[model samples]
Target: MRLEIRMSDLTVPEARDKRNSLASRTDVLDKVGVLATLPGDMHTTTEMVASFYGVDVELVRYHVKANREELDTDGYRVLTRSVFESEFGSLSNLDPRARTIALFPRRAVLRVGMLLRDSSVARRVRDYLLDSEQRIQSMNVEPLTGLEYALRLVDAEKRVLEAQARAEMGEKFKRAIEGGDGLTLREFHKKYFSAITETAFMEHLYSKGYLINQIGKGAVRTEGPKAGTRRDGTQHRHPTYKGKRFFYLHGGGIHGGKRREGTRVRPGHWELELRDQLAAEGLAANENTAGLFVIEGGNSKGLA
Candidate 1:
């Protein structure tokens, strides 16, 4: 006997509901906000939706274009510059006005999936969706064990402790930046380490260095540096509404974007040539601080 393969309404709305169930069960929906049932917007984009079903982006777009009115409810969006900045503000050295990007939210992707009749990907999407429904039906949520409850308690406590640690560390770092004489980091690095570049001087310090402090992929509310001159000789400025990235080690915010060459020196070499240079400039560091700062004109100072 042959079996007839039919499933319930495997539409985008159904698929989304299915995924939301999966997200709650698995709890990894932090990156994309699909499970978030507020008003309209969800982060499962057109490109992402296409990729999820293994279909060509163009094919998805074609289907959406042919069925615009039907899919107009809770569909696509042209992401504005401000929205894009809010999302990817931590990206380093990017021009905010470079270009506009398109996004397809939950309903839009689902509508396209519903309309796609020919692609194998669309068929797979249907199959998985049905499977997901089945999985949801068959799921057995047993009661949490004593150990599991304890583990959750422990995890919550750990998060609070980590937040406190972060706050304390931020204060220490602020003091370090504003600590010593009014010498800027650029002046300190140039005056001390005479390497081909300031970076090689720093990597040496990371090993023999002080308790190295590093900051990565975060926004600075300060002014972005001047980019270039326009054809009309007018200058363009990065908006204060946007944020720029910075990397820091020790007290200097000048570590990343500097490349190193072959055969960097070891600790023994740091005090000999590097420290000798510092002595001439009336500067000195304990063995902990070796050569950890770079010479870019930042407000941070007090490098050893």
Candidate 2:
């Protein structure tokens, strides 16, 4: 005997609500554990937040988006003041401290299931359902009968499944990185770091302890100036040790160059000792400390 699997038919009201919920749910889930509830409107919401704090809307959005994960987990209403304090370091910056005292309303309508299973089949189902609803809306037929709407919903689910399969296959690049096979610098860069700017790249390395301070002037003159320049008329530096060159760290923001303050300079000890140690281990071949970090420390070679 063969077992047949089929989805049960949905009523018109059920189908419509499901479709709307799919879109809403996806948006919320994308930011799950990051936002407590949905914003009324992405644009207007930013403006509202800005007005509340008497700051530029763009800045408010930037801060909000950056700390979305923290906000969601902590609960927006409960953590709003803390989030602002952590981001700006104090409420003293605001002219009227009382304005910053207000918290966001906690009654945000969010379905936890949507956010948790974003990469699972549930997301695909929502996408398809929403697409079907959109198609139905575009039909320009006034008052679609219940049966027609249901049929559209079914068709949408089919499309969503096809789209999901395509998306699943598209994640092969990540799999490649996680696999342990030898990859050339060019290949690895293409697969991972190509889209990241030099500064952002360096910041990431610095955070990981793979890179330290900006390359000194003496090193730059000897090693040949890098492609970019720092504000102090020095060429941006790459990771190096004991005159051996390693990986190149880009020194800009992910999207582009922006002033980044409070980045800790590389400690003198890291440059003197850590560089020599890695070199002694034969990890810094041809001054490729960055590559060694990826292969050995970063576990890049584990990708098969």
Candidate 3:
């Protein structure tokens, strides 16, 4: 059975509202300030910043760009510079007491002073911010304080891991195809998708068009006729070797049908077929598929 999934779309107004709310928050400003202190030439990008801040990249970029624009504005230039100097200076001096005092605006100097009198609480706050910045950097993404930025980093990391896993699976599948091994969908799942359900796993490959239909059920055929049509269908008949039946490809929704009299199931035939297919497709049989596998590699012809 096939199902169509729809993802909700966000409108410009909704996006703007979220951005405004994120920017007004003090925590966001602090994070942005810290990120600004880091070397600009570093490998960090908008995606990395989003991941570090746990915000969506789009949202993080919006706020960061807005913040940068604000900093460039004549009205905000002096205040922004002052904030940066104060934060960095306090951090460099290793004076948590002075840091707390410098954090507040001029109007709140008295209140800040009163809080500083309690040395322990002031130190805790300073330490918390510093520690937070460190944690953000370790993620290999630029740190931002905005809630949106934080959310982006979380999503980016998730995307990265997912991409890595898919790439690995695709490479394994490619090997199986080239090697002419007779691996069942179940066996493939045990090797790769053991953590996921069979139904979901099959659906994922089907949706990606990595596996195509053979006979009636889905099989490991690549680049063939569309469903309900057969004019351009590609079919493979397994060859017997070492008393085993081995097909060019395997590991789809379908397993081999019962053979005629005296024909026995071939063991490990499907795996060999997969390896051979990978070689034929110009992909290194031993290439690391981690996080880079995609159907067609963004080309018009799928799964290269």
Candidate 4:
């Protein structure tokens, strides 16, 4: 005698609901030999998921986009803000400019496995899910106890403290930027965007036309040393007219008892405008922030 499930497609509500019920059963996942997760976090990345199912990353992303509502409801999340850097920053091959990272908890991975139609592994996983629905529902995950439970409690508290630290730092930077004439670009990045070097930020701005090379171009200096040189070639930086609104020419400051001209940015304006600019450049803001500031794009892998 043989028993079989006619439900080849897991997208149907009945099958989908069954998959959800079995999502948390790691013993079943181990029995099926699905992909392993990160060591400590027990989360899997898009690339790893795609590799496991023998499909391109694009296909995995397509499934994600198509079933986002269901997947997100299960456990899918896009990591943005400071939490990403504080948590997964050390992951290998991570692009420094990536402002958003897609993460799938174990349950979410199971959901994806069930939803994927093109992969053979997905087919088998879905079959097993439907075939063992009763068993999976009855399965009980082992509860933590003793030292393991104590360690988990400590880890949970540590995460809470880390979250609070990120919030405090953001608040501190906000207060600092909202004061007086605001911070110089270098100072601004140092206070809020410390992961990005001042040079890299300036170079990106220059390349994006937010800033222009002042020297070696037309417009000779009218005052100070080398006033007659048609091309002063002093490597002075200037914001284009479009980018000028975000900045104000800070009057020369006493440095080593000598004054120097500089520019300062209005952080609030700069932050919003820069996000729009990067969006035009094919970057994106996280959904939580997209409504607040970003103008376009979806999948982001750049400086926020």
Candidate 5:
């Protein structure tokens, strides 16, 4: 007897339930290739769907073709020869004419299972599919309990704090580089030591017993807090030497140590000018040694 069926006779949910119930069974689902398609939108052939339902492929195809409106609503497409070859190229053992109307997606398989209500396997699959969907949904929403969520939140907060600290350190490094070894002289109110004048700063270093003129490159602190100006015109304390309280003075002055061109003999009396100022600051005669100094190669007497 031909299995007479009418898809319209079943309710929408009823038809879905019928299809899904069979889809959930691993045994029948595996036979149909639908079991292997978990977590992915997979496809199955009419032959496979028929095998899962324990029905003839022709009978399954006949009902699907007759009720195309309802069953082919989604993911159903008839592939052309080129499409079949390109997409299912690796699939072997297909019929000679299979490429004429090629692949069937998962929807087609589910639709077929719905239509073949007479098969006992189809009924079981429908039940299994419904159960599986519920189980999957139950597993989807956060698997964590209250304590687990709280612990995860705390870890996330710690990570955010660590990121903030790193960002602060990076900003400080940029500022230090901008400031002249943190001894960058600035023009503040001239009222009372409002800002350390270049001369006063150098004198202070000399007073602390450091040679003011022979200071070298290693005197500047690159990693610590360098002199930085804020957007509001406020300035922070300049970087200081790690051990001593001496100021790191940048090299270069207007007193005439600079050579214009061609003249090797001191063109300007800048060194004398510096020496005179250090003397005024009560510096010992031979003590201008903290800043950059030139070692006279010809004679030790030429050393300044």
Candidate 6:
């Protein structure tokens, strides 16, 4: 009773419909592997879905345009106003002014995997689906034992709870970084380099010649009315040229009669460098690393 499935040949209407019907079997996605997504929800942005399929976001948009009706029916949606804010507001990295954000649920992502013709990941997913369908057709309708049924339910419940926990932590980290130009040294250490205390991190910087206590030659003030001038003896520490690559002195405005001068770490470069450093020291697992999760491709343009 196994039917030949050409799920990847999206041009065939019968094939498209066949795959769309199978989209509900999102358990196959679990077999594919856990893709990085925003914590609480099972949705991913177009860019991330593209990354999962190993294709450019532009290619994803192209497929969306060609199959909008089918995709929309499969729970593809463009969120806006309060809905957008409610769903994605926690992602401080997203532009505050973004009026619309498109989200593809697990079903829609599975649909895309079926529709995509050029991606190797998509091809593999389609092959998996076809083989799975054939196997199901070939199997007898045996009733599951009570123990096996309970195990399945437990596994499903565990996945849901784990996803919820990850989502909460992801939102917390994003909130911690909001309203700031970049991460402070303390914040950076807390998030990415927690093995050592802030004091120890400062000492590491000093020992590595990245920071110095005394105002050396070419030292420039980076904050207050004296900013851009030679750094005075008043400042506590300054970053050397090498340190400046990852950390920068920021803020020069006077608030409450105090000249504010703070150091901030560059995000991407800092994370990469810190990860490498920790790995070299055999402490990579201790680093609180959040890999890229839900990156939306810029603006809704053709997607809307």
Of the candidates shown, which would achieve the greatest TM-score relative to the real structure? 6
* Off by more than 4 A, model 6: 1-11, 81-83, 90-99, 140-304
Model 3 per-residue lDDT tens digits across residues 1-304: 1211111111122233222322232343333322221111112233333433444646544543444433232122222434644433212222333322212221121111112322333234334444554576587755577998889989999999999999997667665343432235454444334565777654544443434334343344455565454342243122222112122233344336733221112234344444354346443333432222222321211234
Winning candidate number (lDDT)? 6
**lDDT of candidate 2 over 1-304, digit per residue (tens):** 1211111222122232343344343343333222211111111123333443344545544544554553344244433555645643342224343344323332111222222222333344344444566687788756879999999999999999998888875455434432332333343333334564545544555455444454543332333355343233232333322112233333334444554322222222223343454336433223333322223433444332
Compared with the true structure, all predictions reach lDDT values of 0.44, 0.38, 0.36, 0.64, 0.46, 0.67
TM-score of each: 0.29, 0.26, 0.17, 0.40, 0.33, 0.46
Better of 3 and 5 by lDDT: 5
Question: Candidate 3 vs. truth: CA RMSD?
Answer: 25.5
**Model 2: how far residue 240 lies from native, Å:** 22
Backbone atom clashes (below 3 Å) for every candidate: 2, 22, 49, 0, 18, 2
The order by descending TM-score is 6, 4, 5, 1, 2, 3
lDDT of 4: 0.64
Cα lDDT tens digits, model 5, 1-304, are 2222433323244455445444333344544342222111255566666766788888887877776665565466667767766764423345676546534566666566655667876666555565565687687565888999999999999999999999996565444322222222221111113344656654554455433233332234445455332221111122222111222333333557652211011112323333454457654443333222232332112112
Off by over 4 Å in 1: 1-45, 69-72, 80-100, 106-111, 118-121, 132-304
**On residues 66-171, what C-alpha lDDT tens digit does candidate 6 reach at each position?**
8899889888998875786675444544557767777898988988888888887777777788787779889887688999999989999999999999999767
What is the alpha-carbon lDDT for the whole of candidate 2? 0.38
Q: Candidate 1 lDDT, tens digit per residue, 134-202?
A: 887899988899999999899999999999999997666544433432232344455444443566445
Q: After best superposition, candidate 2 residue 250: deviation in angstroms?
A: 16
- Model 2 residue runs over 4 Å out of place are 1-135, 140-168, 175-296, 302-304
Clashing pairs in 6: 39-167, 224-252
